[model samples]
Target: MWHLITAPILLPMFTALLIMLPPIHYSPNRRRWVSMVSSAIQLVLVVLLLLQVQQQGQLHYAIGNWQAPFGIILVADTLSVVLVCLTSFLALGAICYGSAGEDEKGSFFHPLFQFQVMGINGAFLTGDLFNLFVFFEVLLIASYALLIHAGGKNKTKAAVHYVVLNLTGSAIFLIALAVLYGTTGTLNIADMAQKVAQLPASDLMLVKSGALMLMIVFALKAAVLPLQFWLPATYASASAPVAALFAVMTKIGVYALLRVYTTIFGSEAGALSGIAADWLLPAGLATIALGAIGVMASQDFRKLVANLVLLSVGTLVSLVALQTQQAAAAALYYTVHSTLVTAALFLIADLIANQRGKAADRLVSGRKVVQPVLLGMMFMVGALSVAGLPPLSGFVGKVMLLQSVTDPDNRLWLWSLVLLSSLVVIVGLSRAGSTLFWRISGSDTVAETAKPLQVFAVCWLLLASPLLVIFAGPLTELSLQAAAQLYDTNTAVQLILGQEVTP
Candidate 1:
């Protein structure tokens, strides 16, 4: 039962080790099966862990048999569980999509994919700042390999820029961690949260500077405004499944920001006093505006997805900036919705691009349209969902976000920006949708031959979109509870304080 708490992290790591063994390494087919089975097992473990955490409240595990303040800890609170589940689910989807063709099922792809998931889960569950840095390295290295797997000149160029930017960010992160460790004499997050407020003003200032520097690192990862230039170029050049996987990667940055700000810095009265709640609101608005403008101006479907990714980040950051419980809850819900819809959109783009290429071949050789109706319907559903139409998960999230921040008079400016951004997203999606599915020139005799498994996986996700909305009540409640866990750390402090004083 206790091991279930660590299963999310352990499962993928164990799977990676197994796949790397000599026997599995010898057979590509066996390796693919091993990868799929391992990811399926990981998905199940994540579900079981979520159920256990729901029943038990919070779960913690000590590494190397040492207790907190003395050794490493992995905490499985609601926020961590939500993120773990999201990562595992996305990994499973990407694995399924990657298993289809010869290029996708190559020997090198699955191991890196497994390692990426392990890194994401480890980062979410880790209770030490240094451990988080280690996990980030694991994830980034895998991503670099996956991004350049196609081995084109463009992908190579993009991967180099991506690697350099992320490495620079990693260096900044290490420096901040060193400053933090020197100031607090501890690396455990929970322990640092406890001591942050008691530090002298000078030391506290140093800590805040470190916090701000760490924020910049995460901002680069999250693709927030000025730091977001690399994302469009890099993601646009990656393969579709790889791009979809990268969607979940940005959430790691948002997760870190929410965790560090609310749990570590927000707990410090002086620090909270120094930074006003609405301080980031204007910057978030600026990000949203920039992303919207970029999307409208972009011509490629891949670049459009990149811009949409930025827009989602801006939306989440703006909600976080609002700093209300309701706003936090809305942000949580929106993040989940955005992750799913964006991934689906990328997969749909892949299908569209593949079909277009096939159509071009058919035109050159004069053949029939290959599964036009199926492609058309998939396109319509994905486009509308991304555009935030009603009866879809996107609509539910957008409505909640709008409802959460209804300050009629003074917030008119904010509402206008939100509305304008939504409209821009609609236009961007519509143009891409029309061009990809409807307006593309093709023959009527083309044969539809996409892998049945891939089509089934895509359909499963499409069906799940509405189901997410249908189950939105319970999921929303869970998100609200998770948000409470993040914003209300005083409960743990009170529990600790009520215990007998120890030397």
Candidate 2:
């Protein structure tokens, strides 16, 4: 059962190798079938692994039969399992949707997609910081290839900026890792967490600085405000399925932040105290405000989805800053909701644009509503969900988050800012919603019929999202347990405490 964690990480790579064989490469249709079959199998493996972890608790598998501190370990705790499931679901969805399009048949597409999944699963499962960094590179490199896969002028331009920015972030990450290893003398995350508290004040400060640098790197990846300029542009220029895949990529950053901050640094009471909550809370609020404004101002529907992605990051960041179990749980819930919603919206954007072009006879009329009734319904649900309206997954997360901030007595203004930002997000989402779906031209003749597979994939995911709201209680509980595992090293300590604990 424990080995199931490794299956999700290995199956894709194995399948990739099989697909690259001569016979498989000869037929494009066969290649597509092979990729789809592989993805479907991987998805089932992920779901089964998730169930195993949920039922039996944390699953640990050491690579090459070596123990921790001396060898690499793969951990499938609730948090990692949840992310694994999400990556599989989104990857499968994107592959399904993309398969229905012409570009999906490109020679490199299937391989890169599988490699991306491998990277994501590896990142989630790895218990070593260095291994995580390696997986990060793997994921980003695949993304770089996919982003420019279309080879258009727009994609090329956006890819350049994306690569340069991420490379800089990677440099900072490397420097931080060097400093951390220099101070702690171990690359294993569990080992580092144990030793981090024992370091001298100066060394601890260095580690904190290193951690902050890492946060900046991830913030850039996650598209947190002030570092989010490149995301909208790059995502807008990429193909829809590619953009949908990028949605899961941002959550990887969020996952790292949650794992590192709570599990490693937050364990050190002194270190956590030095970085006061006030500092992060305000910045998070500012990110939320900026993201809302970005959405409100954007004219392009694709760009609007990009801005909303940023807003989701802001929400998660704020919850992390709060640093409470409830808050972390809220962040977790929102993370799940945001990923699904963003993916759904991107799919809808593709459908709408494709339909509009057909309806307008390929005239490039801007923002025309081809199927007003269907467009109106989806837009209403999607926009309202993004805006955190009631009876949706977003609303549940927000309400929980709002209730978790205990400093209202002393920081009324901060709470006010949070509320104000929520209102601003509502306004921004509403404005975009009305303009893109409701107020746009209502010409049915020009609307082209979307591919059944693409429509089915999008609608299936969108429909699944409301289930998050329905099952909020169980999901929130899972998140809370995961957050507990994150913030308390006692869990890890107990797991290996009786065994060999030495590095």
Candidate 3:
């Protein structure tokens, strides 16, 4: 159990290697089965890790048992443990779905998928800035390959854009790392936090520049405001399971932002405190508006789902900018809800495309689906959930977010934009759903049906939202506990700095 911290990262890595055996001539089913087993193993590991964090407080594992500032380490706090568990659950759903013939489109899909999981888990667990960059690169490379897995001209073109944009962002990330190391003489996050706390107002500007650059890089990955242009085209054009898996990717940026700020540049820091919140508010509002516009203007379902993903990011960023512990907890809650919802929506898009034949998820009517009643119901639930309607996790998350923003300075503005955005989301989804489902012109042609496995995959994701709602009390309590830990950075600093602290 003490060695289980490595399980989440290593399981997927070893599975990926096994998947790449050239002489095995792995069949599609075999690959899917392997991926499923690997993901199940990861899911169990992460769940146990989450329990360890809760019971043991925080768990640390250093590579090769090298101590302190020299060796690589993995830290699992409440926040990171939650994220890893969510990532593995979604990966499992994606593996189950991808196995339904989509993985057959590219020979390397399963291996890349496993690598992608490894990267995501590593990113969440890494204790140093440099390792975070390495994990980012690993995930980005796998995503690039996965995007073009089915081999479409449009997808290839979009993958090119994705690669180019991320490469540029990576360069910026490296520059920021160099600047921070030059200024503070450390890349370990807790070490840097100590240095930043001691940094004077006069000497802080250089480090501030580096922090801003880090923010920009994260924003690019999060698709925040102006940096978001690359996501829709890339995600919308990709295969369904690939797109579904990418759903968790943006949340990684949000996680990085929260992690870095709380540990290094948060309220505990002198000049860097409130820096991100100051800018994130306006930019996040703008992003919500931008995503709403994209949703309305979208001609197809894939693009619409992509826009919804962006909108969710904006919502969380804006709430995060409120800069309170409750806000942080609310953001965490919504992050889980939105990730599950986004993944389900993406899978639904692909499922609906099959049943619609030439209608193919377009706004226009072409043919009726064999399972319109079921699919339509699922879409409505997703839409209502995303729009923050009642009796769902989204509604609970939104209410908590609103409650968290009781700061008299910005409560009205927060309420106004959030409500207005919800209205836009509802109207836009209503129009699109009616157009896609109600205006169907009947065709005599038999519609192609989605695989039973694919349907199960979608159902798995769809049910998570309701489960979140069912367990909202415990989940909210957990998120609040996680938020308290983040705000209580001293305990984290002690652990990360290798001081003798209780587990």
Highest lDDT, which number?
3
Clashes of each: 7, 4, 0
Candidates by lDDT, descending order: 3, 1, 2
lDDT of 2 at 273: 43
Query: Please, what are the lDDT tens digits per residue for candidate 2 over residues 1-503?
Result: 66787888788888778778889877677777888888889889888987887788777788898877778888888889888888888877787787786445344777888888999899988888888888989889988988987678989999999999999988988998998888888877777767776777878777777778777877777777678789888887777778888888888877787777776667453554425355556666777778777776776778778878887777777777777787888787778888888887887887777766533211224446657677667767776777778877778877777777777662464466556766876776666555555454534454566677686668766765688888887888898898877766666745642332232
TM-score winner, 2 or 3: 3
Off by over 4 Å in 1: 102-107, 272-279, 358-369, 406-410, 442-448, 493-503
lDDT of each: 0.76, 0.76, 0.87
Show where candidate 2 strays beyond 4 Å: 269-279, 358-370, 409-418, 437-447, 496-503
Q: TM-scores of the models, in the given order? A: 0.93, 0.92, 0.97
- Kindly give the stretch of ten consecutive residues in candidate 1 with the minimal lDDT sum: 494-503
lDDT of 3 by residue, 149-190 (tens): 979899989988999999999999999999998888888877
* Cα distance off (Å), candidate 1, residue 331: 1.3
Cα RMSD, model 1: 3.2
> Clashing pairs in model 2?
358-446, 359-446, 359-447, 360-446
